[model samples]
Target chain A: MLSIPIEYYLILSAFMFIVGVTGVLIRRNAIVVFMCIELMLNAANLSLVAFSSYHGNPVGQIFVFFVMTVAAAEATVGLAIIIAIFRNKLTVNVDEINIFKW
Target chain B: MNIELILFIILATIAAVTSILVITRSNAVISAVFLVLNFFALAGLYLLLNAQFISVVQIIVYAGAIMVLFLFVIMLLRTDGEPRIFSDKRYIKYFALLISIFVFIQVSYLLLIGSPSKSVTGNQSASINSGTIETIGKELYTNYIIPFEVAGFLLLAATIGAIILAKKKFE
Candidate 1:
């Protein structure tokens, strides 16, 4: 039963985090940006679980549980905000929705 | 080659590819579908890490509930054929690509050069068992009870706020 080294998990997490960052940087759709944010959150969750397993501590997993909770709340509130904005602006494009721009 | 390692490689590939598709797809619905696939793959990875409870929760919460919410919003908004902004900004895309490549190289270099210190706790079997639902339940109910209650309150507030934000105005 040879287990994977923790470094592999950490590296994978890093890869996912970068992908999420790229998505956030390039995608102009608000929903897509939100999804990328979710991806980043999931990346962090993976690292926490990996370290939890490595350290033989249940604490990290508990933290992951909290992260998931926060993610769910975020999605709910975020989508609602998007809907509200779309109602007033009739668009979800980040560039076009800039009413605050001078 | 061990079966666990093989499973990990296959699952990791699936996760990576689907996540790439998630961000690259022009169609929002298609991206959402790919995101669901990515979540499933990640759940598989969680299983590999011996976090059975978290894996199940990942499927239920992410792939199940959250995705359903996303699809509902997509359909409600009817954003199909919405003009994508990716083509309008070539410089941003190139810059993002360059940054991600730099990050990947930096992380790979560090991971390859630095050896992880061996675990000093030494009870790997016991630690592995801590990821089970039973063990997680005990910890959640005991030491982490206050945080759990706070999370519950957070959800309650979010639910109320969402309703307020999205509710129809009858005036």
Candidate 2:
């Protein structure tokens, strides 16, 4: 009975999270940055589900459910902000949106 | 390797590769598509993990709804052929990459070196039932009612906020 170790799922989660971090750092497009954020959230959800099933508890899964809801709300509001900025600035590059950089 | 292991390996590969593609693709639309693929792979992995409901939510809420919102925003932004800004501040990229790789090494090192006991292995039937809709519904209604109502309020606030934020001018 060689079940897949919890560490494997965690390793996968770590890899995705790192890739997401790299994206957030390197990419300038606001939308791309938003996608990277989703990637990070998904990575966290993966580990939560892994641990939930690993420990035979439903609490982690419930947490994942809350995370998903929050993610949805965050995406809508964040994108709307991006849209507002684009309407005014005519750009979504992170480097160029420097109104608050003072 | 058993069927679950084989499935896990395949889905994990898909998830890993698509996530990389999602981040690296030059065009935002292309990145969105790759992200959808990545979500599907993750949904499969969730199924393998015995979280049937979460897996479906991963597809419907994530792949179906959230990614659609992402794609819509990308199209609305019309940011095609935005020149790459990676030419300047090249060292910051390297710095972030270094930090990420370093953290990953630390985590993996801990996981490999630590001999966490195997006694935490869960009962199969219980784990399966734990992920079911019925079990989750009961738990959510009984023990997690406050959080559930709060999430609903949160969604309502988000909807109004999005509408207000997207409005062209304040009335």
Candidate 3:
């Protein structure tokens, strides 16, 4: 149904992945960084869906299913870790929480 | 010219803009809100690509469950008092922006110029029904049964791990 080139979707997702990387590198807030990671995942999922549709492969959709599962799990554990860290450090700023920074 | 193209353009734009906003916003709440918008836009894009099941799952899992979890965590942590935004070490922002722009240009050049006429001709009938719930469910039940079970176990493990990690006093 889509006549638009796959490159367009790939490029858009590429832009998104870059933005996520930029956010991860520069953002001080750890929560914001996690959100950036989600953005990157979303971008990857987009490209995967695009390729899947173009090739008419249900395998790609299956992989996307697995990805969604992993993402959900990752978010839960990651956020819980963040909460625990915040409890101990009283801050979510990456710059400040440097107990392991030697 | 076509309605589908127009919809794709609009959704892509929304996805792009909302993602940028999610990253740039200093306030975590605002970022969470924007991320929801981004997810909705992505769901639209998936719908365009004939990923009917994925689009629904994206909305239910990512937008519905995951984002609500994010919002809950953000509210729980409450990091608003700390001077929101580029107060110290501002150079990191510039450096990151420079690197991201460089990477984006490289990728765009590769995708737009390096690749020539990349297209996939697939079984039209297969593709038409590939996105339907029936096909995905069948695949999940048959060929992907092992992986599906593994995912369930992984989720169970994650739930236990999260509970353990977030406990008030773990000895």
Candidate 4:
């Protein structure tokens, strides 16, 4: 079986990370921004798994499990915060919900 | 040119394209759907990497549970109305786009040109066996047990915090 170079996975992860960053920067919708953040997290997870396989170690894969767990927790808390903000502000757009803005 | 490489190329293409779609679509729900696709494709990539356990968890936790939470929040907020796509200043967007492209080019150049410090000595069969569910379980329960339990506590705290935040009032 032919094997793929690890650089391919790293490059793909970088592309995904950049896409996520662009989404976070440009999208006004807070939830979409949250999705973009999730995208970034997933991109990092992909790289971690890729490197784990490359190094012949299970540590990286185990770390990915923790990352996923944290991500789940983050989603729960994040969505709750979003909902609270939506309830108080009546909108989910980041630009409009700037009570903290000076 | 072989089957594994071909599969990798196909899955990577699907992942990259869907991730782009995830961020570009105007509808949040549509974006979530695309993110689900991206997760599936990433799971396939993990399988290719011989991280079978992580691949399964990627599907279950990411594509299944976390996305459902996102969708639930989306429905709860009723964010169906088209939100403003960008801030009033269009320059910020252009700047962001430019920065993203620059970062992409820089990273790709480094990835393609840099010699990775450690040479990969992992045999395919060894990696496949090492990444098996049984191996992961044994390692997780033995060497990494403390972190595993701490993660359990973190999840519990998150659950309580979410409930508190979503409550109608802090009576």
> List-wise, what DockQ does each model earn?
0.64, 0.71, 0.74, 0.73
What is the per-residue lDDT of model 2 for residues A1-102, given as tens digits with 9 covering 90 to 100? 228777888889989998999899888899999999999999999999988887778999999999999999999999999999999999998999999889
lDDT of 1 by residue, B1-171 (tens): 789889988988888888788888888889899999999999998888778899999999999999899989988895745445456667878888999989988987887778463542224686678789999999999999999999999999999999999987523
True contacts kept of each: 0.56, 0.68, 0.77, 0.74
Please give the CA lDDT of all the candidate structures.
0.86, 0.89, 0.89, 0.88
Give the per-residue lDDT of model 1 (tens digit) for A1-102. 226677777888888889999989888788988899999999999989887876777788999999999999999999999999999888888888888898
Candidate 1: TM-score?
0.94
lDDT by residue for model 3 (B1-171), tens: 899789988998999999888877778899999999999999999998888999999999999999999999999886964354566457777888899999999999988885523655434566668888899999999999999999999999999999999999789
* Alpha-carbon deviation at B77 in model 4, angstroms: 1.2
The residue pairs found clashing in candidate 2 are none
Model 3, runs deviating above 4 Å: B81-89, B121-124
Q: Which stretches of candidate 2 lie over 4 Å from their true place?
A: B82-89, B115-119
Please list the Cα RMSD from the true structure of every candidate, rounded to 1 decimal place.
Answer: 2.0, 1.6, 1.6, 1.8
Better of 3 and 4 by DockQ: 3
Poorest lDDT segment (10 consecutive residues) of candidate 3 chain A: A1-10
Off by over 4 Å in 4: B80-89
Q: Compare the candidates by DockQ and give the number of the best one.
A: 3
Computed on C-alpha atoms, the DockQ of candidate 1 is 0.64
**Sorted on TM-score, highest at the top, how do the candidates line up?**
2, 3, 4, 1
In angstroms, how far off is A48's CA in candidate 1? 0.7
